[model samples]
Target chain A: MQKSYLMAPGPTPVPEQVALRMAAPAIHHRTPQFSRLFRETHEGLKYLLQTENDVLMLASSGSGAMEGAVVNAMSSSEKAIVINGGKFGERWGKICEAYGLEVLWLNYPWGAPADPAQVEELLLQHENVGAVFVQACDTASTVAHPVACLGKLVQKHPRTLLVVDGITAVGAADIAMDRDGIDMLLVGSQKALMLPPGLACVGVSTKAWEKISQSDMPRFYFDFQKERKALAKDTTAYTPAASLITGLHEVLAMIRQEGLAHLHKRTELLARAARAGLQALGLELLAPAAPAASCSGARLPESLDGKALVRYLRDTMGVTVAGGQDHLEGKIIRINHMGYVDSFDIVTALAALEMALHRFGQPVKLGQGVAAAQEILLERYPS
Target chain B: MQKSYLMAPGPTPVPEQVALRMAAPAIHHRTPQFSRLFRETHEGLKYLLQTENDVLMLASSGSGAMEGAVVNAMSSSEKAIVINGGKFGERWGKICEAYGLEVLWLNYPWGAPADPAQVEELLLQHENVGAVFVQACDTASTVAHPVACLGKLVQKHPRTLLVVDGITAVGAADIAMDRDGIDMLLVGSQKALMLPPGLACVGVSTKAWEKISQSDMPRFYFDFQKERKALAKDTTAYTPAASLITGLHEVLAMIRQEGLAHLHKRTELLARAARAGLQALGLELLAPAAPAASCSGARLPESLDGKALVRYLRDTMGVTVAGGQDHLEGKIIRINHMGYVDSFDIVTALAALEMALHRFGQPVKLGQGVAAAQEILLERYPS
Candidate 1:
């Protein structure tokens, strides 16, 4: 019998304990039992986000929260500076345009991070800028932007807010929302939270609330102001994904036990090991300059079919990794390093990659990448 | 040791097998395995909705789907007729008003159903009427509107489509979308679907699609057209709620095994027994005119503290039933009869309610409600 290993960036393997917790009987949302769990989960979210701001939990995927951030924080009269470095970055521009906001796009290569200096120059040029939208880590490109740097630049502009989609970065990386001047920080449950893809938590600063109050954008289900009012009473404006929230409570407890510093350190180490393993296999890094701690992308050999390789690894070998999207499709493979993953998980991924490559007619030495990954991962256990 | 019971209107108890299936390791959503599961789940949704139309699964609560139905079906150039019978019905008007659509509200009492003749009159009077929104079963009031009758009336008006919020009705009651000429039918996973919150399924008729094609309402996360395109390829426009979808696959299979007619009959029987039980305890029915099969609501005695009684049942007696919402708050109690609920569950709920009322000085006879409920529930067990 073959075993399956989930090594994707966003829908990483959920911890068994957390999964079981979510699997428990469903509870009524209006009861005090739910309110207690919600309150605890909200506090856990704040700790995970490294912010004292109000973190509102939503019932949709992360994109819904991204849309809420736009409609809540800005009006059609203002301009939105969107850093389009990858698919997720481009989504910010699309969402802005969809909401009737004029978007000034700063286009960057797929594997490249957004330059904070360029963003600052755009902010200085556009006087009516309401917000600058960027991804702390874009899962599509596996690139981590200079969110803290961009946060610093936008905080100086009193009317402008910095909204960062930390879907792939929040629990894995150490970007402090309040300390970094992030007006709105978004987190998806699936990625570093080690849960499913339903709950989206957004940490909103007081400055962001001020903007939200003034913005009369059309919204109902994802209404931040209404949710805020409900949060004061320890409830959500609408029906929450109660099971996911329960899972979140358990996961946040796990994160707290591990501590943010240790979690970030472990994640960075895994990312480093993944990068080293990929490099050892003679594969070029997709985001070598600023690789995200959540996952790592690497270019396959020009002759090899990366799409076929990924499918083969998944279907034949039972090792699930992600291939590239858009322009990079059929040319790259991405291996995750975040959430519920450990040193051996990285080793298993590298080993699977090596075997898949060899099977695909590439002259690859078996165990070569694993050896390199082990060298970096060994630092976790100082013996 | 105390045993807990979940007897709420929504978020009913999940089947043990379904919960265990969902608790399995998370799978990568972009893979072929997930695509197969998604395709099967989509087909299951169409079967459950009793329609051949495209049933789109969304990652939000039922309200989000209601908003999508409003924004996708009508533009600002047209007027919408909203049946404000309960809290959910009022939400239709709110969503319409939020999106700048002119809403013609047909206000009814909290526990009353919308009149189809009234809706027909509005359609006849309004030249540019786009759609009429009503609920098949409004959980708040436990009222089932005459959806099929309204469908026949709305179908006569080509420009006016019928949108039914079947959140509590789709799997529990008989709603033939295609046969009834319903343009849009929405379902929430937490209700009759026997899954947790986070997934909302919408079945759209060809008429609704024609309207959606012409509508220019701004939307991003809940974009129906974009989702339709992705659904054609066995995927979603954005990242799906993967775990919930996986659970849906199992739940739909269970629904298929228990034929639709059988399921509907069972739900109706349970609802009738619940009403009988409450009546036996000398409580008035909240929606005697048109009680929904998904749940049953009953008014508490004026002298009894309904809120305190409900809290006591939940906290002290380990039973969870929902208190009323808005004006009905602390005056009524709603017991669910949908999803995985059976005869014993009904007996347990009524018994607990009886004991709670007695404890609150209502002089309720212990097991009096249970005896009444069992008499009606006895039809299921014929020798």
Candidate 2:
């Protein structure tokens, strides 16, 4: 019998309870039953985001929310500074350009975080800079950008809102939206929320809302002001992904039960264990300086094909992980450490990696990586 | 114990098997297994749409696809003739205006279908008319517009594309996109597809694609060209609503087994029975001249509160239907006839309505509407 394990960064394994909750009979969106659920879920989102702002739930993927952030917070006449560090960061620039906004791109190498000082310099140089877009953590490179630092920098410019795509970082990392001065924080349900890949929630600060009201951009479905007004009535402007929102209600309950601090601690520990396990195998980290707690990326040896290794793990071993994109393709492999993942899942991943490497004619000890991961993971339990 | 029955126009009850299929473990979107499922579902959509044109599945509600249709098919400099008959028809003009397109609105009274001669005259008068937007069936008024007739008129203008919001009509009505010369046809999953909200599919003809290529409208999440390119790869441009698409695969399979023509006939038969039954209850049909087969709307007696009657039917009798929106808020009630509905469901709706009306102090004879409906519904199983 073959059992599958999903270890991808986003679209992480959904908890059985959450899946069952979503599987239950669908409810009408306009009813008091759904409105109550929505209100509770909205409160939970505020708790998770550590914000007092209104969070709008959208029936779309993270990219749609990212686009909403662009069109709502900035007008076409204003310029946007996009920190292009990875695939998702590049997306910010593309979305800005698509909306006819002039984009000032700050290009960083893949796996490297953007410098806040450089962004500050650009903000000083440009007059009508409306917003700065960056990822809290880019899933492509598994690199966490300096969100709080960037937020502090952008907060100095009243007109420039700090838009952070916290798709992989919101639940996994400790990001207080208000404290961090994040004007707009985007979260995808499939990521740290431990759900499927349809629903996206954006926590919009009062600062962002002011900019949104003045923006004359072309938008209908992703209209933030309309969503905000609907949220006040405990509903969405459009028909929400009811099943996903139902699932979100369950997931948020679990998060509330566990408490945000404990959840963030657990995620960090898992990521640390994963990195230690990979390091024990003599692998170099992709983003050693600014690794995200959501997932970990490591470079494979030149002799080994990372693509085939990932394929072997997924197709043969029934363990799904992610291979690198673009220039890093066939050179790196990424393993997730957040969401419903626990200590053993990390060990299983390390164990599978060791076996897969050994199978590929590499001289590797089977339990070497597992032993290293367990040493750090044991901290979760008693001494 | 109360067993609730959903008879709303949209968010139609999902079939048990389809819900269970979607409830199964979430699958990673970027995989061969998902690709195969996507390809199969795409083929089924083509069959349902009755078109060889590329149908792009988007991760948003039907309104989002409505916006995509406006931005992609027409440029800001071009004038659009919007057939504003009801709430949804008026939405076509609003979306056009939101994107900066000059909208020439042909305003018809709610529940009244637009005249093709008027649209033809407008097309002839406006030199740079890029498109004509109308609904195949406007859900709010339950009116079916003359799509085929409008198509014939719009076909004469090489520069003008005909976009139809077939949210409640595609599967319920006999809308053959290619034969009708429709440039763009939009479908929502919740209406006749027996799925939840958050998934919308747009069938784009070659004529629409030609206009789309020349249009330089601002769009990112609802970009038709990007979606078309991804559909060629058997996937969507963005992360698809995977769970909803999974449900859609099962639903389309059911549709295929039932056959499109049979499905349409069944819907029309149900709508006919519903209208006849409501008329028997001494009620007036909302759209007597051109009622959509997807759902039936009826005007209530001025003495009775339509909203309270609807609430009693839903809360007390455990039968859920729709109340009117906007000006008709307390003046009308709507009952759905499409999506997983049979003759008996129609009878249940009518019986509940009769009981609710009786409770609300209106003279409603129990089974009078049922007997009238059964006379027509009996055609489904005649010897």
Candidate 3:
């Protein structure tokens, strides 16, 4: 059986060390051993999130934190301006709407990141908006939303919390949530954390907490107050995902050992090589924004179906990639270079894409993409 | 570092193998590999829950599932009948109250099981009750709440779903969800599964489904309908705790390999031997009515504090026995012999307990507990 290399966004390829951590002995959550583990994890998460705000560690997916962000930060007293350009941005709107929060939507096409000017314009127009949700790098668009700029402008509206979904962005990008005026930065472990998705971490600003106290929405499992109280005791509000925590411990230790800046640089390098290689193959970038940017959406020639190409890459070349969701399915393909990625991975993925496109009868130059990627790598990185 | 053995009901010791499985690579939730894993896990969960109901999984702790049961399974047309005998039981009432549901609580004293007669009487008296939530075993009390009689009685009120919090009960005891006619059987992976506490799995019967549809509670993250829909698609409604799921895959495989029947017998044998050994050491059990079936919840002599004994167990012997909670603290030391345990583990725990007691100047004899435990094992196995 040919096992395809998972190059799509999280769950990213977990390091063997982290996976081993998860498979190790289960520690009692309340025991001193686990408390020390939990305490260390809390410290590590705060460092990753770049915040002094007490983080709410959840045992659900990224969306659970999204729901928590919405229910805890926004109330019926004011509307939330949801700038939806991608799937996750749309999700923020849907979750808030489900809780009966009035929404002021600023939607854009799926391919491009929402303009910061557009979001700032929306915030100004919708004065009643108490919160604004944006995806730092919306996975569907593969474009890095200008959250630091947008968050700064939203800070002007003190009542409007700048809630950013950093699910695919946080550890992959230079995210200083505290420095960026982000009120609530939510991330899942599966993506940039280089672990599985069972653990969700939220970086909350004091501004968000003040809103939480006054929010009339009925929040239970993901309640900030409950989570805060638990964190005060150096534990989770609920029995936490212990193995995931162990994985987190391992992943964090790996990152710390490697240095966060070094890890981020590696991801940037990987994304750069992937983008350079894909461009050389005559594929148009769906969003050619930055190395930190993901979805990493690319379009095949109009004659070739992107969906079919995704399968071809997987079925033939042993490289699993992502197909576009909703309207972009047959038009766009996503190549993920988020966590636990190295230069050789880029070579393997490019080789697969080249082979798969060749099989599709595309008039392509063999090994041209790999050569181009190597050229850029040689020029930029000594090794 | 003195590595301690976890003697808590949950976040129990993870099997060496399960920990290894959790350390596997993190895959994208949408990838074909994840699709295969999700499908395998969904099927594995159904078999483990012993129910044909839609066994939905969550990326949260067991408390999340308990909250899900409260917010999704019970209808607003009627009140929630909660049986509070321990911390978990009180959780049912708290969750119900959080959803603004009218709560009818039948609370029993600590260290005692909820009487089925009381549950039946409450259901009969309150015809408006839509559901009754109880524990199969109260870990805080170390008392097994017999669900056989409660299951039979709750059957009469088919509309009044019987929700069993089997967090500490699932693999530790002989509680079968389907055979017992349980509408909602909730289990946390951290306890009897010998895994960490990141995932919460629930057995939702068809009756529970109908009631869920009628539920007026507003929920997004814990919504059963959304989760069930995602389950049908062989994916989680949210990004799951993939590491936890990976760990779970390994743990369940081990369980199925051991077979449920044999596991139950081993657990019973271990529990019996441990309890008998403790009793022979002159420790009096707190649950005089039921022999404290799963965990050996016994009070040390007045000269010893359970808390200090627990500390000594950890500090001196590397055995982390649990001290009683609430008013029971310092009075009773609960020795856990749940998942990932066998004869030697119980013997080690018993010997540790005896040594800890001896250090406290309370123990009457040496090797007495081990000798008694040996006799039980010999008589039971006859080998």
Candidate 4:
């Protein structure tokens, strides 16, 4: 109805430039123009995935890549360990179990980081474990995992690959797949990359690729070997979702231009500003108290109607934020500071939150949250 | 350097209007705006597919939908009849075999359509042929199969389902799914609909959905059950490719505005023009003996190299035509008259073919092909 802001964890507001590029004339995949774009995106995806592993582009959502990571890299009858603290974390176990794999999942309380110790214990205990799956950031938890710590365990068990769903963490979080020793790092264009969600970018290590060679899994579309063969020519094995790839080419170019380090820092600053604003508003964060952070979250104040507040913000103000899921539903609200976020956006979100709370009969000091958010913004990036 | 033209069968050039819609803005999948767009596209896809079956959307290529049809509708152990007449047709057998299914293929030469009688014979002979899979128009052969006729046989069997890949034929061909008794028909946005690829739409009948209820083939990403469940809410089980979905919505509006009959007629007229132009150019069609009758398949002249000629048109004159695959490679060239085709486009393709042939030292009369194409266009439309 209006110029909307997607303050969700993913499918975040896309850049105008990326959208324009997607609208660019489609090039035949077999042609040199497409070949060049495909090669660059493939290379850029690997770099974004931060791995020396061969990167594969999939014309699917982030979950498709997650399913692809397990099915192609491990036999269906094999066992795998997954961390289930939130929706996406549970997704790994669900995908593995659907394939008849024996899954050892360490389920943590929602809104808490997946305990690495428990994951390590599960990995050591599960004799049939062929892979260890974890999401670097669980949007449902509003918490980021210690992937560098988990990567160490997977490095020891070379046969058991550590797969990370970096949907919410790829560009926003500091992930160096090579340095962190991640076997399969999965990402999509929609999240922190500031593009749409039609493309899933997966980095597959040599170890993961070798597992695929022996896998008898019945996969045709997500078959890593077939995709690898096509990737060699900088083309997809099957017809790809072309416009999304075109959009990604633009988004990747922009990312390269902005520099990964700079984007990460910008994202972190936005997250911090949001967190500071919520604290100043006398709200508790839904996430477990820890140094590890992701999207800023705040528990709904007792006097504020969470649903009504969020609805009012969306309808009256033009700010769209995500409400809590599962157990945390109706108890907290999440304001995503990922994808193309800057200090101004952080201040705007807080200002909208203040207005919505007031409209919902939870009257607060005028400009309380915005003032604090602006204070953090000035501290981090002074005007 | 110039605006590209995608002439591939699938992933054809996307409409500029649709691209503009995609670039408009992002919205959350669960939001009302996205749900509205998703619902519109779903309903529009059903109309285009001409099936009462629920049309499900997947964030993958056409191949993913092909995989979904095979894996979700039938188990790995069942006997299935596969038709392998071209590259895409071969995929039916390959995916089935990969899944350990006992396949009885009615193999025909790649360039020709498999006879429906042969399919009937195979079904009669096989003890337990659970399903049938085929491409309505195999892009590799540029030939249209008698899907309606094949559906008749499978319809009589009742136990056997007629699954057709309408990926290349959906928006262009006249294979009405419900009218033809097609149980499952799959298509992507790239082909006849003139949208960039990224979303694969599958129309599954109640029978197919019933099989899906009990299917044991392991699946998570391309899970039809999950998608079907989410369809009830007019949203996806997971985050959808919003921008691509947005683009698809706009494309559907265009298709609806043009009406299916009008679009199909336009395609037919252009196809006839291309065929006439190729004939006037004195080129032999590889499949002329039993031509597909839709896409013109011209055999390379004796002195002209097909691959080099294709490159010459693309590089020198900015025309992108498809070269053949596998056995057909470098032996023939394909001119598509599917999406967004007009008499002028036919003229451009004819001119490019003539120039490429001249460069390759083929004997050709100046402007002969273009003139013939124009004459055919005038005669057909009386303008």
Candidate 5:
């Protein structure tokens, strides 16, 4: 019998208790019980987002919330700056263009960290830019963007709102939304929240709400104003995804119990271990400039089909890891260490990678990667 | 100690097995394991939607899918017919208006059904109408529109695509999308899919795809064409709610084992029982023309506050039900019987309502509503 290990970037493993909460009977959205639950979830999200703003909960995917930020923050004819470094960054430009906004795209090479100095130059060029759309960490490239520096820089310009898509960054990193002067910080539930997808939380600053108040973009279901009004009453404007919220409450409690600093450190250690393991196996890091603490992307070894390696890990060993996307497809593989994951998960992924590579006709030591990961983990976890 | 009973219109109780599956480690989205799971989910949705057309999965709430149908099927300078009967029906107009479509509104009473003949007249009057936006069942009023009749009526207009927001109807009722010529049938996972509220599935007809191809409306995340192409390879266009999809596999398995006819009959029987129980308590049915089998909305009896009644039931007895929206607030209460629920749930809700009424100085005979519901349930489910 083969045991399964899931190490995907977004839909990471959910805690056992959290999953049990999701299975519990759903409460009515309009009832007092749900209202109380909703309030707790709202407050918990604020804590998770590290913001004083009333984070609005949406029954949508991360992309929907991303779209909400664009439409709510700027009108159709306004100008915006988009940092297009990877797949997710390109998404910002796409959402902006879809809404008829004039997007000034700042192209950065994939697997390369975004340059804050270049962003400063563009912001200076476009004085009337309504918002600056960016990803805190481009998940596809596994590169952590310099959001802290960018946020500090963007705060200098009062006219532009810094909207960060922290889908894979928020729970995995220590970039504080309020402290960093981020106008809008968006996250999906499936990532470090240790819950399933279907819920998105966006923390909006008072400054962003001011712009949202004046924006003329057409919106109804994703309207932030309606969400804010309902949020004050401890409910959602529409029916909130009840089970996911319940699960989120449990995950947030777990995060609280563990403490955010500890959580971030844990993820960082796991990421470091994975990186050490891949380097031990003679694999090149895909994003060496600044790797995300959530996932590690490594170039595929010679004579190994990236797709075949991933398939062998899943089918032969029952371990799931992600292959690269777009241009990097079939050339790289990503191992995730986010949400409900620990050092052992990294060991399993590395061990599976070694076995799969061996099966794919590569000459390598069986436990070299896992041994390298263990050495790093032992120093950090000390168990 | 209070035992909880979920009787909400949506976000219904999830089965234990399904919840456990959702809590399971999330597999990689692009892996063969997930591809097979996705393929099965796609097939299961087609079966649930009762449509031969391909069902596209989305990572948004029902409203997002509703918006997808609107923006993907019609351009900005188009005219559409909207049936405004209740909150959900009015949502059709809201979405259409948000996207800048000229909507010919057919206003019906909030609790009343749409007349097919009047719709025919509107179709004739507005020959240039490109689509008809409607809800199979308006959850706010618990009114199930005659979608089969409307679909047949709209089918006559070759240029007009029939878009039905079957958020609470597709799995609860027996309307066949292909058989009725529904161009677009949208449903949320939080309803009868027995899952959380983050995923939406839209089944598109060939005619709808034709209109979608010609639609010049700018779309990125909710793009149906991109979704179709990705679906052909057994994956979603964007990162799908992976855990929810995992839970969905379990829920669909349960539905298949029980059979659709049995599932529908069970919900119909539960709705009938709830209606009988409320009527026995001297409460008026909100939608007598055609009530949705998913929920039963009742006008509160004398000396009862709708909001207080719902709150008391939830806070005191741990039984959560819904209060009405808009003008119906504090006047109507809705008892849900959708998805992963049965006769016992209706009885529990009725008993709670009776107890709450007694506590609130209203003369309520204890067990009266429960007894009435038990009789109907026994007659239908004589095991």
Candidate 6:
């Protein structure tokens, strides 16, 4: 039997223990039992983020939290700087425009990391800019930005808050919110948390809360202030994605037990193996400058269609990876390494890629990529 | 070891089969496999609703569907009639008001069902009224409104559509939307579908879609048209609550196997037994006139605190039930028997109530209620 492998950046494979926790009989959200569980989750999230800020848990996708961050922290016509490097980075600009905010978009090519110096110059020019939005690691291009470097720049401007969409970056790599001077950090359940996609946690710094207080935005469902009021009592503003939160509780426990440093190290090793294996096969890296630990982007061989290769891997080999979106479509394939995945997943993905390339009439020898990945895995585990 | 029981009107007990289905490995939503599964779910939901209309699946609580129904079908400042009998009914008016709709509220007493004649008169007098919102069964008061009668009245006014919030009513009772002239019907996964509280399904009639096409409302996340467009391709507009939808697939299969008529009959028997048992102990039903088959609401004896009794049942007996909200707080206890529940659950609820009442110094003969419930159960399901 060919067991299927999920290798997507988001909706990543969940640990069986976390999945089973959601399978247990449902509990009412208003009960004491649920409150205790929610509190435990709060502590676990704080520990994971390495922040003392109040992290608000919401019931929608990470985009919903992104929207909340925009409406809650910025008012209409308020100036904000958005670093547009990839699809997710571009989302920050789109959301700002939607909320009637004056966006100063700093555009960058896909697969290119954002330059902190460029951001600093923009912030200095537009001193009235109330917020700066960027992704810790843009999943679309598999590029990681220097959040700590950007945080240092934004922190110099006390009125400007730095909001990091750490949806794919948080657990895969350590960019501690408090230590890095990040004003807001967003993390979703599916990416690196080993749970299904629904719950989104937004860690809000006190500085960000001050901006949220003065903002008069039309919001009911995604109101951060309403959520903050409820969260103080260990409840959500609305009915939470309860089962997802329950799953989050178990995954958080798993994270706490494994420790963030170890989890990040494992992901680093997986990404390293994937890069080593793909490079060994003569494939060019898409984000070779600063590839994200969560996922690796590689340019498909000139003869191969990335979309068709992705489909073949999913349908024929039972291995699921992602193709590029928008303009990058049919050009790159992204192999995700974060969340509940290990060295074996890298081998499977590389092996499947090698077979797919050979089937597509490329000059790829069998076991070449797999052998390279195995070398890295063995050196790390040494068992 | 004692096992806890979930007996809430919503977030009811989920079957083990459905829970286990959710625990299976995650699947990417954009894949062909997921598209096929989503299409199958579309067919299953249509069968459950007994309608030929497009039933759109959403990723939020049932209230999100309710909000979508309001914003999609009616324009700003358009007049609408709302039947306010309980918490859920009141919510319909509030959502309409939030969107700047001119609401003509027909306020019914908490336990009283809506009168069709009043709605008919309002529809005739206010010919410009665009829609009428009513709950098939108001969970807060355990009252089932006469939706069939109401639909007939609203149908006479071609411009007015009948929107039914069937969150607690759809699977637990028989309300054929097409036959009863309902334009929009909403259902949640958590209630009688034996799943958790995240996914909502909205069935839209051609008549309602006509209005939705012309209506202009500010919406992004709850855009019905966007969801309908994506659903045509067998996917959701946003990243769906995948795990909950996975659970829903199994529960819908269970519903199909049990047959809609049989499932409704089972719920009817359970509610009947619960009412019979509680009444035999000299407790009066809160909604004696038109009690909902999904749950039974009973007024506490003058000497008992309904809140304390509910807490005792949960904390001591491991049987969880609900207490009344708003004005009826500490006056009524709502015993739910919907979704993955059987006759045994009714007996357990009655037995725990008897024990709780006895401990609370009330004159409750221990086995009197259980005996009455057993008699009804035997008649309904005699092996």
Runs of candidate 2 exceeding 4 Å displacement: A1-383
Where in model 4 is the C-alpha error above 4 Å?
A1-383, B1-3, B289-294, B379-383
TM-score per model (chain B): 0.99, 0.99, 0.96, 0.95, 0.98, 0.98
Q: Which residue pairs come into collision in candidate 4?
A: A241-B197, A241-B198
Put down candidate 4 lDDT per residue, B238-280, tens digits, no spaces. 7787888888788778888888888777677777777777888
What is candidate 6's CAPRI-style docking category based on DockQ? Answer: incorrect
Give the interface RMSD values of the models in order.
Answer: 25.8, 27.6, 26.6, 26.3, 24.3, 25.8
User: What are the runs in model 6 whose C-alpha is more than 4 Å off?
Assistant: B1-383
Q: Score the docking of each candidate (DockQ).
A: 0.01, 0.01, 0.01, 0.01, 0.01, 0.01
TM-score of each: 0.52, 0.52, 0.51, 0.51, 0.52, 0.52
Per-residue lDDT over A147-209 for candidate 6, one digit per residue giving the tens place of the 0 to 100 score: 999998999987889999999998899979999999889999899988888899999999999
* Candidate 5 residue lDDT tens string, B275-345: 99898777899999899998999998755678877887676556689998999998899998889775456
Cα error, candidate 6, residue B169 (Å): 52
Q: Write the per-residue lDDT of candidate 5 for residues A1-383, one digit (tens) a residue.
A: 12356788978887778876887777877889988888888888888989999899999999999999999988766798898888999999998888888999988888898888888998888768899898888899999998889889988887789999999998998879998889999999988887889999999999899989889998888999999999999988999998998898888878887888988887888899899989988899999989998889999975667887787666655678889899888889999988877644665577557656766677756556765775576554221
Clash tally, candidates in order: 0, 0, 10, 2, 0, 0
Model 2 residue-pair collision total? 0
lDDT accuracy of residue A187 in candidate 4: 84
Candidate 3 structure quality by residue, lDDT tens digits, B1-383: 11256776666887656775775567877888887888887777777777777788899998888988888877666798888887778889998988888998888887677788888888888878888888888888877777878888988986789989988888768777878989999989888877877899998988888888888887889998999899888888999888888887777777788787877777777788888888988988777675444577887777666787787677655667788888787888887777876554665566556555666777355446655665555333221
> Against the correct fold, how does model 3 do in TM-score?
0.51
Instruction: Give me the overall lDDT of model 3.
Output: 0.78
* Cα error, candidate 2, residue B329 (Å): 0.6
lDDT of each: 0.89, 0.89, 0.78, 0.76, 0.84, 0.85
